[model samples]
Target: MKAVAFVGYKKSGKTTTIEKVARILKEKGYRVVIVKSMHVDFDREGSDTWRFSRVADAVLVHAHDTDALLFRAKDINALFSMVSADIFLLEGFKSIKHVPKVICAREESEVRELNDGLGIAVSGVIASSGIREIEGLPVIDATKEPEKLAEIVEKRGFMLPNIDCGLCGFNCAEMAKLIVRGEKTIKDCVVLSSKPKVTVKIDGQVLPLKDWVQELVEKTIKGMLSAMKGYREGRRIEIIIRD
Candidate 1:
């Protein structure tokens, strides 16, 4: 998966530009997911979603036509893991450093607020305002040429699960940097891989057990499973050790 952010102040056309860019990418046969951040209170005081919030952190509303999740937590990383798509377009999340961003603004001053070394391109109303580049970043007209913007994002964007689990020998942020430098591949993320991994730690050091030890552990697990009444050969099981 690949990702980029559409960032700007309130009403600066970030949402509109994201919508256009998502449409353009989808029309080109790419699956896209849009993640937006809202500052104001979005839930009503006395609504079904509000009532669900009182009892649960996440509520899935499933009706005949559509299904939506009303989630209260502000964990973008968790959300990223749940969504599967070819491209992920983020609105807001200006402070996140793991992903590149396209800054949209109505004025040059708003464009200046973007962090250094984070922006991949500029867009929205400010892109067509005679300033072709800011801080050496190229400007792409998001409203008029959304396909071009989508292409740029497709070429340059990347995604990390953002869980910081460190199973890949690097945190999500470190993996993102490595990916940009061509030193790492997305498949290196163990969390997203089809095969599961087991780690052993003893006395504050990770233990790299030998192949024979691993084989012994597997056989021992199978032996224990053979004692169970409903044991099956194809079932997968997980075991955890605290110490």
Candidate 2:
């Protein structure tokens, strides 16, 4: 899925621009998920989930038509594997450089402070100041031309696997900026496009394999599965090893 981060200080119009852009993408039939970053407590005070959180490390409230998993963690990448969407609208994460960004600002000084070579567009109250471009980034009026803003996002936004294998000569975040600037394509990302025959991840991080090692693992697994009942030439199988 492609992801775009909207980042600025509090009350910098990040929410409004994200909402407008999400509406336009939805109208175009793209499934969008907005992930907001905040430090506020989620569960209501004295509620069942809140009470459970006092003793438990995590709380899962299985409410009707919705489910909430409350945990004391702040990493946004934790949700990437759990969520399915065409686009991800990140509400915060100013320091994350892997995804495309729209910098929201109310003044020119704010724009100068926010641009860090990752921003694709500039929006917010600063867009009303009648300026066209700031630091070579387009100034888009999200309220008046949300479609235009959405198109920019659709064109430039991307989510890399962030494996940083170094096969691409640069890091994933650097590659994202190159893609946005027309210097590179998504095809340049080896991890994002790789279809490994045998994959392994320990503790949420993928373990890269050599070419010969991957072939050996794939062959061994296929040979073992070939003798199983109901096994076909191209069947999908999963194995879980636990201590």
Candidate 3:
């Protein structure tokens, strides 16, 4: 999947630009997904819902029909796997890697040393009444012309993944949505930097086995022992060994 992100301070029109770009992409016959990120707690503290009862480090919610995800994470990488889209538009992750992005600037004077970083796909500047283009980067006018933003995304490729796994802290669906909005990234998933593997337990003993041979042996023993017991509903069989 391809991904892009929009980054800027509050009232810089990041959210408005994302919506306009998404609409234009959808009209062009491409499968698009959007991911949104928020630091605020969506669930009320005293709510009676099950999800609210046990507070987790983060919470992710998905809507398949709209192909959107709502992600909440303390860290940035919490939504990597949660995004699923041919093209992902993200809204707010500035610390991740390799994402073609648009930096929203209200004016050229507002540009600072922090804008010197690489990986910026485009920079949007708010013009007087209509959108204007930056000489080296694409510019988006948040107030007058939002559709031009979609043209920018189309020139760039799709922006995110679609599996919606919570390994990133956001559900897969939510990640996709935010990616389109320019809000998050896969590198944000610090958890994935470490490899993943299946865990096994034997005779109430946990084995720290990393090799396939050990896993195969343990699985074979378990399967054999399970079949040897003549077990049925409400009935049990015991095995005795003779020396």
TM of each candidate vs. truth: 0.71, 0.83, 0.50
What lDDT tens digits, residue by residue, belong to model 3 across residues 1-243? 566777767766677777777777788877777766667675666654336437653444455664333334333333544444667777876644445567766665434422434334344446553544453554556445556656666665443323233556775445544554558655554333334243444322223444564568555656666666563433333333344
Where is model 3 poorest over a 10-residue stretch in terms of lDDT?
A: 201-210
lDDT per model vs. reference: 0.76, 0.84, 0.54
Point out where model 1 deviates above 4 Å: 44-48, 56-67, 81-84, 107-109, 167-170, 181-194, 197-220, 226-243
Question: Judged by TM-score relative to the true structure, which candidate is superior, 2 or 3?
Answer: 2
In model 2, the number of clashes is: 0
Residue 155 lDDT, candidate 1, scale 0-100: 88
Clashing pairs in 2: none
lDDT of 1 by residue, 153-192 (tens): 9888876656576767887777776765567767776666
lDDT of 2 by residue, 1-243 (tens): 799999898888999999999999999999999999877766778988888888997887787899877775434555675668999999988988788899999988888888777889999888878898999999998988899999999988887766667777898778978987889888888766777777887645566665678899879988988988888887676877776
Model 3's alpha-carbon lDDT is 0.54
Better of 1 and 3 by TM-score: 1
Estimate the overall C-alpha local distance difference test score of candidate 2. Answer: 0.84
Between 1 and 2, whose lDDT is larger?
Answer: 2
C-alpha displacement of 83 in model 3, angstroms?
5.1
